[model samples]
Target: MKRLFLVLALLSAGIGFYSCTPEPHFDNVPVITFESISKNTKLDGFGNKTDSLVIAVKFQDGDGDLGVSSTLKEDSLLYKTTYNYQVRTFRQVKGAPVEISQTISNSGNFPRLRDDNKIGPIEGTLSRAILIYPGTVPKNDTLSFKIKIMDRARNVSNEISTTQVVVNQ
Candidate 1:
């Protein structure tokens, strides 16, 4: 009985110590890290044969205000400039990489991560699919992408780049 009581006491003390641990501290500005990019290509649509790739990134924000509500309305000018996530594409040309013309808008908003009014740090991974349609670039082009995220406060996160990948393969 004494041995069982001692074990129980030790378990309770461990639980109490864990419960007293504080949350991790993070900066107010968002920070993002490149997680991965899908190597295998998938069909963009049911019937369409165009290839698509997915890029994933992990992000952390101290204030937990990292996304926007779909119902929120704003001026067209403001809306155009406000994007929760931005992705820039680069293609290998000769021996160097060049930024492609901004014909496709890969930047867009993400749903609010936290719904409650309570402010706290939050972190999560975000993945986005990019289409590699015909005529966009030469077939089997070597490409890489730069990604960044913005919090609801318009604080931009550090940019990160993904490994080079062959598209339309």
Candidate 2:
């Protein structure tokens, strides 16, 4: 009987491939940090009169959104995902560019792990340091940076860096 019709066609193709397999989703991602940036070491820290730049960050979420990236180097700084999610942005490598303002979802009265050290009020969040007085920059140039985090069904986190600002000329 052709081996019982080949075992009933291999159990009807394994029950239609396990009933069209599909099911796997759990959103919860957001954690970022970079608590410092007031650089203006004598107008050579790469700047352009950035209205007093300042950037310091810290985030840990269960919904999604945090980001920063870099390539502005004169010394060293880089990181853009080993894994984690939602939104991340940060850039610099030649002249001017720094604008970070992000807050995505999460009003569950977060911050309960000993307040995770600090920086957590939850009102559009806050943590940054930046000061760009772009008037002088030249010395082994190579700058790059990135910091990102995301959740709220966007899930993304993993990108933290700071390096390549060795302009001690």
Candidate 3:
């Protein structure tokens, strides 16, 4: 009876560990969707705040191929994460709303790979924070954002846009 109890305990531990880890990826490309965006305003040395936007997203991949191949080389940094962003700032113009647009691709790895040789679907949430400097825009201006991600197969996820945010000075 003691031997049987020990076996069951070990089996339970193994299952718990497996469920917490990321599953292997199959051949299908990963899919990601926009979740939410919120601002983290902090005061600088001059007592002025530069907006830090936290972007949240949900992702699923049949073949867990969403991250870089390796983390040792310079090339790995380029393919690891495909966090892309497009921003538009709205100004209160005389007649129509004046707007400025900018596009950017983030660098570095997000560590979204399986640890074993198995192949299966993986799903999780990814969050990134970016600092936005309100250079020329006047106070009370508004801004919007569009974002997307890519998988190892170079499959681009559906683009998502954030709601209008007031430029807090």
Question: Local distance difference test, per candidate?
Answer: 0.84, 0.40, 0.63
lDDT of 3 by residue, 20-91 (tens): 966455436666677888888888788787788787878787876666445435455444333322233444
Best by lDDT: 1
Predicted candidate 1 versus true structure: per-residue lDDT over 8-27, tens digit per residue: 99999999998896887889
Native-to-model Cα distance after best TM-score fit, residue 121 in candidate 3, in Å: 0.8
Model 1 regions more than 4 Å off: 1-11, 39-48
Estimate the TM-score for candidate 3. 0.63
lDDT tens digits, residues 18-117, model 2?
A: 9895533322445556655444344334542332333445665532222322222324332222222222333454465453443421111121233233
Cα lDDT of candidate 3 equals 0.63
Q: How accurate is candidate 2 locally (lDDT)?
A: 0.40
